[model samples]
Target chain A: MEESSLLPPVVLVHRPPALDFIDEHLSRHSFTALYTHTSLEDSLQDFLSSHAASVRAVVSLGRLPIPAEFISNLPSLEIVVCASVGFDHVDLDECRRRGVVITNAGDAYGEDVADLAVGLLISVIRRIAAVDRYVRSGQWTRLWDYPLGFKLNRKKVGIVGLGSIGSLVAKRLEPFGCIISYNSRNPKPDVPYAYYSNILSLAADNDFLILCCSLTDETHHIVNREVMETLGKNGVIINIGRGGLIDEKEMVKCLVNGVIWGVGLDVFENEPEVPEELFGLENVVLSPHAAGMTAESLNNISEVAIANLKAFFADQPLMFTVQLD
Target chain B: MEESSLLPPVVLVHRPPALDFIDEHLSRHSFTALYTHTSLEDSLQDFLSSHAASVRAVVSLGRLPIPAEFISNLPSLEIVVCASVGFDHVDLDECRRRGVVITNAGDAYGEDVADLAVGLLISVIRRIAAVDRYVRSGQWTRLWDYPLGFKLNRKKVGIVGLGSIGSLVAKRLEPFGCIISYNSRNPKPDVPYAYYSNILSLAADNDFLILCCSLTDETHHIVNREVMETLGKNGVIINIGRGGLIDEKEMVKCLVNGVIWGVGLDVFENEPEVPEELFGLENVVLSPHAAGMTAESLNNISEVAIANLKAFFADQPLMFTVQLD
Candidate 1:
């Protein structure tokens, strides 16, 4: 094969240092690469107009929203690679229609997300946020009226999704002396945790149910009124994954009625605008969707995104190609 | 020994359900116990005035500030047993001058305080407080660029004062994959942690230096500028024992100048009033002297307090006796 035809030029639209890794790897393979650091709102037309002739693919980390018009305009763009797991911002159908391959950096943030998940779990169960607020407000003249928060040790933890992130959550919780049980599409390999085939069954048996699975048509709002009721009055629900995986209204009702002891939510059904009712509740601990926002996860996502982009251009097996029929 | 001659009437300042254990234990003897949920400020005078003839000693939970005048008034109060480790609130010198025996619940709250010490250490290092704030503030959007928190795994943790709480901290940190080292007056038993034997040397070698020893005359202001300077820029100092263990003025200067990565303080020299300067600092996490404020600890303290009171009255060996020369 001729060297000229062997490799194609690629453009990465993410942050540098991470892109530097891709640049270094691609240099070894004799491929021409153009790196562009652009914001999501910036006109992609300018970049396409300047580098469309040589740009074979675009690897992005929130630099561009893969819209239908953007996909159609990039004549030479063969693939759109996201440096993150969530593809809600991408126009997947349009990319499929244009025959532009889409890949995402999935499971790259599993450990980081899982760490946040367990951290949130411990924070909420231990009433750390409430205690901190009390101390900060100067209301801690004496010991708190309520008992110190409960320990995570020996509590039964139910995982809603036993995917990579869920498995990692289990691994972290395991050291805390929790008995782990998980609900998923199918049972995972030789794991130590007990697998529950149903969410309600899992919730009933566990003190906490953590949401770590992906949001899909089948998994959407999997935790509803029945599941919350099954989780009982002593149960806590922690959602570090997509908010759509839980029913917010139902959760509020359960929380208010003491069907659940508390909730720690990092992701809500709607971003930025969360339910105002969740604000003052001492039992609830809420975070803006930032469970996977650690620096380590960012680096992991960026590295994975670059590798996927590099692998696609090299005609090798791409790490995380999104299937499109 | 004659049972009636050996027995004495005791007055309990505060009574909880756990006192039943002590009552039951003492019932085997011939001691007369009078329990009351008295207000420390006013009821002590009334109880002493009414029961001075019958009352032989007083058992307390350390909630009452036993003044010298009150001790002078109690003609029948031969011993004052405190159900807490710290006896600073009590007039120890007064007791010694008046020939009144004083016993403190020293080892009772050890495990509980140790638990809180480890909890604060993990909470601060993992950015649990900040993350909780982020969630409740409703500003959670991108996980990236929010906070660059680190995991507790694979870090060098130094403990000052390898006493009960210090040893417990080491045990807890051991499971979290941290290399534990300590400085103490004397080395501890068969533990795997490296004993530094010197405070500055311990702080220099570790990522986190936790103050868990006593704040005696010798250990007061041990974590001063020179020791902190040895800790360098990447170090974190946690004070869970006493505020006097670290010089707050020097700590503020170091924190402002980035001399250390962060500080987690459960105890302050003049707390319930935290230094106003520490309020806005992003590197520090503050608590209002609550390292031993867990519900379990409270119950444990109360139970042990009752036991000590009962034991003193029955002429049995008191569980925790503070010696006064």
Candidate 2:
């Protein structure tokens, strides 16, 4: 007890300058920052080499990558607590190789992401945003002729990767009379919805495709030109999943040529740099990669991350630990 | 049978030039327009006097009022077929006094209006429309600081008038983890949600108030300043019902002063002329009275109106007949 009181465990926080959400809540821990400002390149190696042995756990914030090279420097690192739902930014293989455990934000963000997915779908189908512009600009008064939007009821909705977020989306959409289906690696026994082993069949049968899968080598660019072609002219695509899951160039072209009906994108292949072509088109609704972000959800995420870190320091079981295999 | 075949019942269509949806489908029966090219003033009295005896049914299109004066002119008018869900535009007392049966669009618009109500709720809470604007205006790259929106999960949702549209709204919100309650003239026996006898009590208890009631004498200005005050600063109001359902002036003040959280208005007291003050606010999402204007719903509305007219002519039971009692 005397030794423990004298020396508290160290936690290394690696985050972008804008994401200092954990600083206030992490007061109990003996913490060190690897990068305080924008440029992590100048002091990253120096900080890692000096504080390598003392750091017991690293808190990765936002989507900043924690690659193999970064993991190799932290020899005493016992766990990586990611403050996000998607841990694709973290090197799972490296962490597993070093016998390091990883815990993600888990269901902390499931409802929020699912909420955004549903919002985007309805917005695109109903032309909520487009008509908003019309009303705001006083075009409604002048023209009195606004184009009619499509209905969401009984439309075939295909969810890609029915994980925690995707499942929540399906449940929320059920009462709207949407015929829900999915494309996943394997079908679960419990769910009532039809499952396709591949993306093409799912796209071909559905009126709308909602992407909720994680980004990985096998899953990256899963929604390409062919998958969209099969989805056809009347189909709509909604991506609340990672940007890498879709081929952005092909999507833009398809939208331009009317190969697909429309899309609602919260994530883009190159974020904060959306294709300029989308700006002129009324069919596409673009968001600034804000799915999984809300005041309550952010608070929940910080609490989960802090709790996981606290649990690790106390030698207790971690929450939402990732299966490395 | 020979007389019926020789001279079909004449139906009077009193509608604006733009609302000629029934023209193509009404060829089966003899239909005459009161006004063809936007000059109803020129021919209304002449048309009414000339065809009063022959006109068996009046197909009231859009919200053009069928007042007591107009009802008095049509001496032989047996029924008023409203091609809209709401029949407040038709004088109920006069219709009842004259033994004129009234039929409305009924459940044709139930799903679409409910969909828009939910869409507006999510859009207002999540800032979906605002964020889309931010992304479109190239502000996302410059600021990197979009304001956080509130979560919808577990929110206390109070629905006004738990009828067809309100019931569907409540049903759709259930799976999103929203706690549902409602304000109605009487408690609905079949619904599982909690009931509030008045708007004030409902507003006081809930985080979100969705107005789905008809605009009648009892419901006009239902959401006044006092109601908004009771709803508090964190509360949101979504009105897909009608502009008259709320006191628009007070609502504008509440939004401007932050007396309430935000609003999503598809209807205004004077539509096509939304309050200029609401234009600059980020919290309010304005829609152009288009909640029931989806293409599918429009088609459904037309079909239902036509079917009801056919049934009335055939002396079969009418569909969606409004109870005069």
Give every candidate's TM-score on chain A.
0.82, 0.89
Best by lDDT: 2
lDDT of 1 by residue, B1-325 (tens): 2553555565544333333334554455455666654344557568667766666666665244667876777776678777667877778888888787777767756655665566566566667677667656766544233455666667899999887778877775665557988899988788778988889888878889989888899999999999889999878888888899999999999999988888888788876668778777666677666555545555566567667666665578876677876
For candidate 2, report its TM-score.
Answer: 0.89
Clashing pairs in 2: none
Q: What is the C-alpha RMSD of each candidate to the true structure, in Å?
A: 5.2, 3.4
In model 2, the runs with Cα more than 4 Å from the true position are: A1-12, A28-35, A38-57, A67-79, A91-101, A142-144, A323-325, B1-5, B8-12, B16-20, B27-35, B38-56, B68-78, B91-101, B323-325
lDDT of 1 by residue, A1-325 (tens): 2763555565645443323334554566545656554433556577666766666677666433567766666777788777767766777888777788888877766665776676677667667667777766656554334335665556899998887788877876664567998998888899778888889888878888999888899889999999988888888999988899999999988888888889888788976668877887888877666565555556667567667766776688987788876
Task: Kindly give the stretch of ten consecutive residues in candidate 2 chain B with the minimal lDDT sum.
Answer: B30-39
